[model samples]
Target: MHNSKNSYIHTSAKIYGSTTIGENCTVMENVILGYPQQDILLQVTSQGKQIEDFEFHGCDIGSGSFIRAGTTIFSNVRTGSRFRTGHNAMIREKTVFGDDVLVGTNVIIDGNVSIGNNVSIQGNVYIPTHVTIEDNVFIGPCAVLANDKYPVRGEYHPIGPVIRKGASIGANSTLVPGIEIGEGAMVAAGALVTKDVPAWKLALGCPAKITDLPERLQSLNKI
Candidate 1:
């Protein structure tokens, strides 16, 4: 039962000896941390660096954020207070999640991304790098946002699409890179976004096309 001045860790949790935990946070039981292992399959990276920085390994977890059991927060990640993620979620490095963000189970958040406050990302979502998810955005389950249209073999840059504020990406949808999903836009389930989506427009299909409507998209129209 080791003790720290400003952090809380449960005795049942088996974190690696080299892992560094931050202050004002709770480390739950049965949490397995495999750090400093190069060939491990669950290699999560952040900010173009390996998740290895001991100090500031994770960002400021706000006063009220409750991270569920089995969640892995990679290195170089800086998030605002009240950041909550579901069980077994993987938040990759250098990602900034704003206050009151909720990421559901089995979600894979890639590196160098920015998630705004009050956003809810449903289960099993994949967010690649250079993607900006603005405030009040709802990303449903299995939503995959791709950043590279023509991904090269050994080149890495700020690639991928932009998801604007108040946008709702449906379940099982794919967002192609370099495109901008306008503010208040709605992408239907299973749609493949290949081009720019205008603001307040509803798009759906294999090669997603815009749908014209009188009233702007206020909320997610469930499929």
Candidate 2:
């Protein structure tokens, strides 16, 4: 771990190889950052589309970030300024987060995801890979996001839900794969989203019916 002089790394934290921590970052106790994933898909000769192999390459954390205790971030995870995390958060490799992101307690973010600036993810959220969360997005507590259509022994095609800018997901909501939560959309609590939600609308019910809700979008309504 190559930390800047201004960064504060706790004694109990375990940081893996070649991680570059920027200025004035705070790494709390028992935080594990930059560790690599053991399993990886090497190559596919027929398609000739070569994805880069996963390794313990490195990670770059921007300035003024704060990582709480027991937060474990895997290798190749990149983040911009003011990245904050709560306790026991697990972030995997190839995940990119923009500036002013807040990851709440016990949030598990899987690999190959892109999160934009000013995103707030609340506690106990499970975010799988191939997801895109745009700026000013708010994910409430216990929300579950998936990527694979049929995860168990499926054909390895995974497409996560896309949360657009200013979108808000309420608590205990489950978003299915390959769906889009449009800009300024609000998802209700305990909703199951199986389809795309339009911009500046509200989604509710099992299949998540959408409707124009100007009040929620304007005031940023609570779940």
Candidate 3:
């Protein structure tokens, strides 16, 4: 199959069957789109899961998107228009990314994730499965978001963290699964987020604790 004039796929990139790229998109060299899943880790987990929800096939990319070099986007992923990813990124299957999203380089995004519009995830971030990131959010570089709380034989289905709209996560912070980050909240750099952060608050320290919003942001949106 041939790509339209509105779209450009580099010669070195490999696009598998059942995937569709929209108009005005540029996929750079060595960028792999719509590759099948291995799911080796899920196989080792409890076997009798309802397989339909986790189907892995291919993907659909929206118009005016830009995929950088060496990015591997797994099958069954879908993204809206104006989506951009940095080089050497890993976006797994069963993920949905909204419009105008920016994913930085060396980011690892697992399956079953949902990212809202106008979100920016910086470089070297790790996001596990079952996570929901709301709109207008900013995740700093090197932030690690986990999913599995108790890894005892994977007895239960894992649920990742929920980042509310307009939230900001600082660099090198670690987020435990199943917690909620309130809207407009800000987490400090290198903090370990264990609990829920209230709306418009600031969180800091190893086990993140809420503080008054910074003077700069507080005046903008007082709560």
Highest TM-score: give the candidate number.
2
Candidate 2 regions exceeding 4 Å error are 39-56, 219-223
Residue 156 C-alpha lDDT in model 3: 68
Off by over 4 Å in 1: 1-8, 14-26, 32-58, 152-158, 214-216, 219-223
How do the residues 25-119 of candidate 1 rate in per-residue lDDT, one tens digit apiece?
Answer: 66676544432332232444434444443322233345455667887765456567666778888776667778778899899887789888788
* Best-matching candidate per lDDT: 2
Better of 2 and 3 by TM-score: 2
Model 1: pairs clashing at backbone N, Cα or C within 3 Å:
46-93, 62-81, 147-160
Model 2 residue 166 distance off true place after TM-score fit, in angstroms: 0.7
Instruction: By lDDT, rank the candidates, best first.
Output: 2, 3, 1
Q: How many steric overlaps does candidate 1 have?
A: 3
lDDT of 3 by residue, 1-223 (tens): 2355679888998876467888899999999887767662264245654333333456788889999999998878999999999999999989999899999999999889999988999999999999999988999999999888887766767889999988999999999989998888898999999999988899999988889887677422211
Q: Return the TM-score for candidate 2, rounded to 2 decimals.
A: 0.88
| Residue pairs with backbone overlap in model 3 | 6-24, 58-76
Clashes of each: 3, 0, 2
lDDT of 2: 0.86
